[model samples]
Structure formats: structure tokens, C-alpha cells
Target: MLQLIEEIVYQVTGKNGLTYDTDFVQDLALNSFDVMNIIGKFEDHFDTTIPTRDVWHLHQVKDVIDYLAGRGFTQP
Candidate 1:
């Protein structure tokens, strides 16, 4: 999942080396639009629409992994 997330993030930012604790805004220096774009990619990839309320809570890479894991996505 992390690998896949990294791929998606790279697609947008043309950047990599993200850690689990990386903050979307602080570490990636992304604005809300970029964040939302990444989220949208995740949703499309998983075929799941994360609730907007829940989406905002996912600020870190680990947070996204946790949220998807809770929905049955595997870590490895």
C-alpha cells in the first residue's frame, strides 16, 4: 500500500523518499488541492470514496495507511 501510495504521490509531486510519518503539507509542501488530488487518486485506485470528514483527518502517510488498513487494505 505504501508503495502504491508513493507511486501516486510521485505522479503528482515528481518527488519521493516519503516516510510513514511524512506530513502531506509540511513534508511534501503540498497545498489543499494537491492533497485532495492525491486522495482522489487513492480513492480511484481502491474504488472507495473516503468520507470527506474522514479525509481531512489523514494528514500523514501513516494516517492514510491506517485508514485504508481499517477498511481491509493490507500493509504488505
Candidate 2:
């Protein structure tokens, strides 16, 4: 799951290096547009809808994993 999330992040941000603690904004320098794009990709890949309110919680790679886990997604 982490690897998949990293791939999505890389696809969206075009950044190869990332850590679980990396912040999308602070570390990856992703603006709102980039975040939206990432979110769209995530939704498409996961086949889930992330609530707009919950989007802010996904600030790090681990956060996204946790969110997916909470949604009943297991590591593939």
C-alpha cells in the first residue's frame, strides 16, 4: 500500500524521493491544484471517494495509508 501510494504521489508530483513523514505541502511542495490531481488519482485507483473534509487529513504518505485502511483497504 505504501509503495502504491508512493507511486501515485510520484505520478502526481513528479518527485521520486519520499518518506512516510513527508508532507505533501511542506515536503513535496504540492499546491491545491496538485493535491486535487493527486486526490483524483487516488479516488480512481482506490475506487473510493475521499470526503472533502477528510482530504486535509491526508497530509503525509502514512496518513493516506491510514485513511485507506480505515476505509477497509488492505495492502495489495
Candidate 3:
């Protein structure tokens, strides 16, 4: 899931070399619109709409996996 998020970040920022440590807003220069688009893709990919309150809590790749797991998306 982290890898998939990396891919989506790459696609969104048009940055081919994005890594897990890459900061979404700093390293990637992602704005609010880009964030929304990425979140949309994530919802579509996981078939779950993440709650808005949890959106601001995402700060890294692992956060996404944790959020999905918290939502019961536990596919290994």
C-alpha cells in the first residue's frame, strides 16, 4: 500500500523519483488540489472514502497504511 501511495504521489507531482521519505508538500510541491486528487485515487483504489477528519493526520507513507488498516482494509 505504501508503494502504491508512492506511485500515486509520483503520478500527481509528475516526479518520477519520489520515495517514502519524500514530503508531500515540500519535496513534491503538492497543493490542496493535488492532495484531493490523490485522496480520490486512494478511495477508488481501496474502495473506501477516507473520513475528512483523518485526512490532515497523514504525514507519511506508513500513515496511509495505518489509516486503511484502521478502516479494516487488511489485505496482505
lDDT of each: 0.85, 0.83, 0.74
lDDT of 3 by residue, 8-69 (tens): 77777676565556666767677888888889888887787887778877766667777788
**Which 10 consecutive positions of candidate 2 have the poorest summed lDDT?**
9-18
Backbone clash numbers for all candidates listed: 0, 0, 0
In candidate 1, list every pair of residues with a backbone clash: none
Instruction: Tell me, by lDDT, which candidate is best.
Output: 1
Error of 3 at 1 (Å): 1.7
Superposition TM-score, candidate 1 onto the true structure: 0.89
Show model 2 residue runs off by greater than 4 Å.
Answer: none
lDDT (0-100) at residue 35 of candidate 3?
Answer: 84
Tens-digit lDDT track for model 1 on 1-76? Answer: 7788899999987879988999988888888788888888888888878787898888899998988989997744
- Superior candidate under lDDT, 1 versus 2: 1
In candidate 3, position 49 carries an lDDT of 81
